[model samples]
Target: MTLPPIRFTADEAWALAAALAAADACAPYAGAARTAYQKIAASMTGPVSVAARELAARIVALPSRTDAAVRAAVEEALTGNKALRLSSVDAEGRESDRVVEPAGLLTADGRWYLIAWCRTRRAGRGFRLDRITAAAPTGERAQPHDLAGLLLGSVAAGAARPVALAALAPPS
Candidate 1:
């Protein structure tokens, strides 16, 4: 079946607004977000649909949930369906490189994570933004991966909340 655009309830919309506000990583895209929101908002009057409201909030705070250039490159790769090379330091403080198919950016507890299909590891991985030292597009095409599925499987230690997971996902 074809996927329909996801909709948010009133509470979800409010949560998204709060999430966006706390998304300091995405602050650089404020102008773009406002422009996009304005364009979307222009179509409706007075009150908006829950989906539109949620979308406006998400758009305003989407992209660059970390270092602007690194996160921007990753987001560009995701939008273009291209592979990206990332240099990051793990918890061990050792640096490693990976070519990943970009999926989405997620923020939980004020920390940002880049969810992706890692060619180096041959699996899904979440790289913390602060640990990523460099990121650039590889020019190679990327295969599509289920963003939600990757997120579901990646969250561990029972630290992630369902509200965060739901608020961060892009429309299907």
Candidate 2:
């Protein structure tokens, strides 16, 4: 059976662009998403379309700064619901190895961060992509955790929340 065309807003498009751009496997999906964004923008009225087109262009043009191999491993951990072994350096330049349950990836300010429940600290942590020296799938299934809850309640110091697509809405 043929499916009806799906409708998505500019905000959703921007969110998807931000999420996909941080991944190593962004090439194929980015192209398709851009085409879809253009189509959606065409269907929108007035400034929304203009804003969407501009945002689409900017988001697509922004280069990913996350290390490819590390991004891949974290992505795998998330997709496979497996734990991730991470070797990362703290701000003070101390390196530590830890296992974490990959919850989500946040990209902001041209940087990527892996949000996870840390086994080392027994708490949630947002490991910056640049700080991660290595990432590998641990093959062990991750413990169940709610991402929204983790984001809201964690003691992740200086954890400025990731923006929602609705926050990117064009001025009213």
Candidate 3:
């Protein structure tokens, strides 16, 4: 079924507004995107159906119970003066050095990523920090773009294609 555009009830509108305000006041991080979208969508007068409201509610509610330490780390990574040299193995199994100016840290689908401007790639790219063996301050830094400036929207996560997993019968 096709998802409808988000519409909000009075409570939803108020909640969303508060969420956006909190997000703005808190820090520039990836956790706030859903809330930000909800707040903005709530204010609009349109046909926000039950499905849309449910989706918005899920997004708004996702951030409430995260660990404090992880959250702090994200805030620091986004706003701190640090250039992390990320190492990755490409599809060709080649090691690469990606010098990036981290703008934010995004956690989605149980994965953490450093959203930064890749100096080598000469564009904005999301680097999975788990693959990074080293992250040290270069002592030289670049100005970070504002959250909205680097607004990737849905592009940050690529398209998902279905994959099958096979299970074998136990050996006798």
- The clash numbers for all candidates, in the given order, read 0, 0, 1
Judging by lDDT, tell me the better candidate of 1 and 3. Answer: 1
User: In candidate 3, which residue ranges exceed 4 Å CA deviation?
Assistant: 1-77, 90-92, 151-154, 157-172
- The best-first sequence of candidates by lDDT reads 2, 1, 3
**Best prediction by lDDT:** 2
The C-alpha stretches of model 1 lying farther than 4 A from their native spots are: 1-20, 26-31, 34-65, 156-172
Please provide, for model 3 over 49-162, each residue's C-alpha lDDT reduced to its tens digit, 9 standing for 90 to 100: 444455544553334333334344434555665665656655466777767777766655555556777789777777554455445555566666543345456465542221
Model 3 residue 16 distance off true place after TM-score fit, in angstroms: 20
How does residue 14 of candidate 2 score in lDDT?
60
Clash list (residue pairs), candidate 2: none
TM-score for all models, in order of appearance: 0.60, 0.59, 0.42
Report the candidate with higher TM-score, 2 versus 3.
2
CA RMSD (A), model 3: 14.6
Q: Find the 10 residues in a row with the least total lDDT in model 1.
A: 39-48
Query: Each prediction's Cα lDDT score?
Result: 0.68, 0.69, 0.54
